[model samples]
Target: MKKVILFAVVLFGALIKAQDKTDSQFKYLEYDIEKIQNLYRNNKVTVKEVVEAYFKRINDIDKNGIQLNSVITTNPDAIKIADSLDHLDSKFKNKPLFGIPVLLKDNIDTHDKMPNTAGSLALKNSFPLQDSYLVKKLRDAGAVIIGKTNLSEWANFRGEKSTSGWSGLGGLTKNPYILNRNTCGSSAGSGAAISSNLGIIAIGTETNGSIVCPSSFNGIVGLKPTVGLISRQGIIPISSSQDTPGPMARTVKDIAISLGTMAGEDKNDKKTIGNTPFLHKDYTQFLTLTGLKGKRFGYVKGITKGANKKVDDLFLQTLKILEAQGATIVEIEKDWISPEISKNSFELMVSEFKDDLNDYLKSLGKNAAIKNIDELIAFNKNNKEELQYFGQEYLEISAKSNGKKDKNYKKAVTIAQKGSQQGIDSVIKKYNLDAIIAPTTAEAWKTDLKNGDNYENFYSSSSPAAIAGYPSITLPMGYINELPIGISFFAGKWEEGKLINMAYTFEQINPQRKVPQFLKE
Candidate 1:
C-alpha cells in the first residue's frame, strides 16, 4: 500500500512539473522584443534565462508537442552568447536588440559550426567559408543568434512543382495557429519561428513570395526591402537581380529594427558599396500612430478581391480603418504587370541560378558538392531522398537554356524592368500614391505532398516589387477560419524608409496580431 501511494505521488509530481513547463513555455509566445527588453531592463528576466527558456520550449514543442519542425538546428553556442551579452557594460543596454535572440532561415550562411544546408542533405555537414553579411551585422549589433531554421530546399527553385517548406533534412514546417496547415515556402521557418515566439525575429530572403507568403500564412510582418538595401553577398542566390534578405517578425516595429541593423554597405558586395548613407540608424522613430493621416494609398482592387469572403471582409475592415484614420483610398484599375515581364523574371532566375550557384560553390572551397549545375543535377538523380519528392524540372529546363547569351533572356529582362518600372512605377506616380496596397496572400492551405504548392489567388504584389527591386512590407490583417491572411504595401524604388514609416503607422493604429495557442488544455 505504501509503494502504491508513493508511485501515485511521484506520478502526480511529474504531471505537475510537465504542466508548469508547458505553461511557462507558452507565456511569452506573444510578447514582442520591446516588452521583453523592458522586462530585462527591470531585472524581471535575464537574457541568459530568457534564452534558456526559449531553447527548452523549442526542444519540447517545436518538433514534439506541436511538431512544427520550424527549427533546423539549435545553436549550441546560444547560451554562451546570451550570457556574454547579459554581462555587458551598462552602455550596451541602449542597443535596441541587445541580448535579443534571433533565427536565420537555413539558406543564409553562418560561419559557426551550424550547417548552411538550405534544408538539403546535399550539404548536410557543409558550413560556409564565411558568415553572411546580414549574420555578421546581427552579431555585431549584440543580438544572440539562436538557431538555423528550416526552409524549402533550394529556396523552392529546384523543381517546377516542389512543395514549399518541405526538405529531406528538416521536414515540413507547420503553421503555429493550426498544426495541420501549411506555413508556406522558402523562408518557412523564419515565419513560424517568429509567429510562435521561438525567437524574437528572424531573417528571410526572397526571390519572389518566400518571405511575404510565409509571413502572411503565419500572421507576422515581413519586409522585403529594396534589393540593394541589404547585402546578399554570402547568401545562396537565385537571381542576383531579384534575391534579397529581409526581416520577418510579429510586428512592424520589430521588422524596422532588424532592417536598420542589416542595411548597409559591405566590402565584399559591390552592389551596396555606395548605399550606406541611405540606411536608417533608428527606425522606431517612424512608428507614428497617425502616419496614415493624409497619405494617399492605392488599393489594387483586383487581387484583394480574390481571397474567400471572410478574408475579403477582414481586408475591407482594415481599409475602412485606414479611411477613418484620414488616409485617402484610391482604386487602381490597370496597374498589372505584363505576362511577358513575369516570363522574364523566371528566365533571369534560371540564367542567374546557373552562374551564381556555381560561383558560390567554388567559393565554398572543398566542402561543396557538385561544383556546377550539371553536377548538382547528376547528384540529385543519384540521391533518392534528396530528390525523390520533386524532380529537378526547373534545373533541367535551366540546364538546357543558352544561359546569359540567349536573346530571349535579354528581351525578358528588358520587359521585366520596363513593366516593373514603367508600368507599376508610373501608376504609383500617376495616383501620387504614398504606397500601393493589396492582399499579401490567402489563408494557409492544407499541405499536400502528393500535389504541389496549393497556390490559389495570391496578389501579384511580389512581381512589381521584385522586378523593380523596390521595398515592400506585409502585415497580418485577419484570419480565415484559424488560418491567417495579410495585406502588403509596396513603396517605390529605394523607398524603404517611407515604406517602414507607413507600415509602422498602420501597425500602431490597427494591431491585429496575436499569439498562437497550439497546445491549449
Candidate 2:
C-alpha cells in the first residue's frame, strides 16, 4: 500500500515538473527584439531564459504539436552563447539585437556544425569554413544564432516543376496558418518559422519572389534590400544579378532594426561598393506613424488582373485606407514590364546560375559532394529522395548553357537591368511618386507535391523590383479565408529607407497581423 502511494506521488510530481518545463505562457511569449530588450532591461528575463523559452517553444509546437519542420537544425552552442551575452557589461546591453535569437535560411554559410545545404541532400554534410558576411555582422551585434531554417531546395532553382518549401533533406515546410496550405519559397521556412514565433527574426535570400512571396503567404514582414545593401558572399547562388539576403520578421520595426545591423559594404562582394554612401547604422529613426502623410504613391494596376476578386476588393479597401491617411494615390498603367525583358530575364538567370554556382562549389574545396551543375544533375538522378517529387530540369538546362561570357548573356543582363530599372523609374518620374504599391502575392496555395506547386491565379509585383536589383518591403495587408495577403512597397536603388517608412506607417494604421492558429485543414 505504501509503495503504491509513493508511485502515485512520484508520477504526479513528474507531470507537474514537465508542465513547468513546457509552460504555456512561455510557448506563446512574444519574443520580438524590442519586447525582449525591455524584459532584459527590467531584469524580468535573462538571455539564457529567453533562449530556453524559444527552444521549449520549438520543441513543443515545432517539433511535436504542429510539426512545422521549419527549422533545419538548431545551434548546439545557442545556450552557451546566450549565457555569455548574459554576462556582458551593461554598456553592451544597449547594442541592437543584443542576445536576440535569429534563424538563417539553410543556403547561407555559417562555418558551424550546421551544413549550408540549401535544402539539397547533396550538400547535407558539407560544412562551410567561414561565416557569410551577414552572419558575421549578426554575431557582432550580439544576436544568438539559434538555428538554420529549411528552404526550397536550391532556392527553387533546381527543377522546372518544383514545390516551394519542399527540400530533400529538410522535407516539406508547411504553412503555419493552415497546415495543408503552402508557404511560398524559397524562403518558405524562414517565413513560416518567424510567423509561428519559432524565433525572433530570420534571414532569407531572394533571387526573385523568394523572400516577399513567402512572407506574404505566411503573414510576416520581409524586406528584400537593394542588391548591394547586403553582401551575397557565401549564399548559394541562383543569379548573381538578383540574389540578395534580407530580413523576415513579425513586424516592420523589427525588419528596420535588423536592417540597421545588417546593411553594410563587404570588401569581398563588389556590388556592396554602391552601399557605402547610403548605409545607415540605425534605421529605426525612419519608423514614423505619419510616414504616409503627404507621400505620393504610385499604384500598379496591371498585376491585379489574375488576382482573386476578394483579394482585389481588399486591395481597393487598402487604397482607401492609404488615402485616408493623407497619401496621394496615382494610378499607373501596367506598360512597364515588356515581354522582351521577361524573356531575357530567365536566360540571364540560367547563365548566371551556371557561373555563380560553380564558383560557390569551388569555394567548398575538393570534398564537395557535387562540385558543379553537371555533377549535381548526376547526383540528383542517382538519389531517389531528390527526384521523388520533381526532376532537375532547370539544372540540366543551366548546365547546358554557355557561361556568363556569352554575348547573349551579356545582352540579356543589360536588357533585363535597363528594362526593369526604367519600368520603376518611368512611373516614379511620371508621377513624382515616393514608391509603388501592389499585392505581394496571392494567398497561400494548397501544398501539392505530386503535381508540384498549384499556383492558381497568382500574380506578383516582385519581378520589377527583383529584376531591377532594387529594394522592396512586404507587410500584411489583409486576409482571405484565413490566409494572409501582403502589400508590397518597392522603389529604386538605395531607397530601402523610404520603403521601410511607408511599410511601417501602413502597418501601424492597419495592424492586420494575426497569430496563426495552426489549423489542420
Q: Whose TM-score is greatest here?
A: 2
- Per-model CA lDDT versus the true structure: 0.78, 0.85
- Candidate 2 residues lying further than 4 Å off, grouped into runs, are 1-24
Candidate 2 lDDT: 0.85
Error of 2 at 159 (Å): 0.8
Every candidate's CA RMSD:
8.7, 9.4
Q: Which residue pairs show collisions in model 1?
A: none
What is the Cα-based TM-score of model 1? 0.92
TM-score against truth, every candidate: 0.92, 0.94
Per residue, candidate 1 scores C-alpha lDDT tens digits across 1-521 of 00000000001111111122464546676777788898888989888898998898788778676667999999999999888878888788768678888999898888988988878778788788899888988888888898989998888888855677798799888777766567777899989888878899999998888888889878899999887888998898888888899999988888878788888988877768888677777776777665689999997554544435555677778889899999999988653566677777888878778888888778788757657788878878888887776778887877777777766777777777767777777888888988888777766666667676654543435667877778889987876665677888987777777877888888777787876655221
As a TM-score, model 2 comes out at: 0.94
Estimate, for each residue in 356-475, the C-alpha lDDT of model 2 and write its tens digit.
999999999888877898888888888998999988878888898887976799899989988999988988998999988988876777777998776445566788888889999999
Against the true structure, whose lDDT is highest?
2
What root-mean-square deviation over C-alphas does model 1 reach?
A: 8.7
Error of 2 at 109 (Å): 0.6
